[model samples]
Target: MNQQYEEKLLNLIDRMVETASDDELFAGGYLRGHISLSAANCEMCGKTSVDAMNNAVENSLKETQSELNPADQLIVNAMWEKLRQEAYNK
Candidate 1:
């Protein structure tokens, strides 16, 4: 991710942590790792757009779906979408 989007994502996650429910908090932390790692992977592959970053994150999560229960996966996906909108949609 670009520095601006990276900072935005960090700020968004910080705010979410402050007000999120228990489930959201858990999903936030879990998704943070995926998001950051995905961004890094995208950068390494020369994919810098927000869409590329989002796709990497989603694909990573899908690859590890067995790690979370169905409901938790839903929560994580929802949070990811919300964060993506907040970060990229301005």
Candidate 2:
């Protein structure tokens, strides 16, 4: 289940490469790392739920929140939410 969710998240990001604006592209790329890492962590910890994966990603983002400026942070946050919703709906 975690792997499926991770793939959905990654597919959403991958689909953005062709038409995403510069900011969206940047946000997607930035989020890919967090999502991938969180998924791996979930796997290592034997966590299979999508919620666990999402929480791990959220925590990872908070941990590195200082890396982005306020505007960039907003962009990434918005993109993350969008991706999460889209992935969940699929």
Candidate 3:
């Protein structure tokens, strides 16, 4: 993963710290771990595309889906999609 992509993703998460609701805050914190891990994995595997980074994050979340209840899974998934879109738009 490129440093720019990782930075953009982290920036989005950081920007949400002040105004996000409790659920959004939780989702952001949870996603931060997955996003960081995915970026590290992508870098290790020589994957540099945004799509690859997104896929890696999505796969990581899916792999751990059982850890969260359905509502939390929905919140996290929605947050991921929103962040992904915003990052691309920026």
Candidate 4:
């Protein structure tokens, strides 16, 4: 995994968490951990930034319950979907 890409992903997620609404507890916590783990796990995986971030987000989402608000879910899902498509295209 590319260090710069990992940092990019973390920056995006950090921004997301910072701007999350009060009810987005799951999202904030999940993003925080995902950023940390992504930076750690993909430090040398040889994957592109998109792949690493998508994998990190999906993996984190999988581990937690999905009790999310529709709006929050919509935002997070959209972000992930866009990144997923970008990763596949790369």
lDDT of 4 by residue, 1-90 (tens): 455554554555456566756645455454556656765666656555655666776777656527566677766665656544543544
In the range 1-90, model 3's lDDT, one tens digit per residue, is 356887898899999899999999999999999999999999999999999999999999999999999999999999999999999888
1-90, model 2: which lDDT tens digit per residue?
Answer: 999999999999999899999999999999999999999999999999989999999999999999999999999999999999999999
Can you write out model 1's per-residue Cα lDDT over 12-67, one digit (the tens) per residue?
A: 98897777899888888998788778878887899888778778888999999999
TM-score, prediction 2: 0.98
Full ranking by TM-score? 2, 3, 1, 4
Q: How accurate is candidate 1 locally (lDDT)?
A: 0.83
- What overall lDDT goes with each candidate model? 0.83, 0.96, 0.93, 0.58
Best by lDDT: 2
After the best TM-score superposition of candidate 4, give how far the Cα of residue 31 lies from its true spot, in angstroms: 0.6
| Candidate 2 vs 3: which has more lDDT | 2
Clashing pairs in 2: none
Ranking 1 against 2 by TM-score, winner? 2
Which candidate gets the maximum TM-score versus the true structure? 2
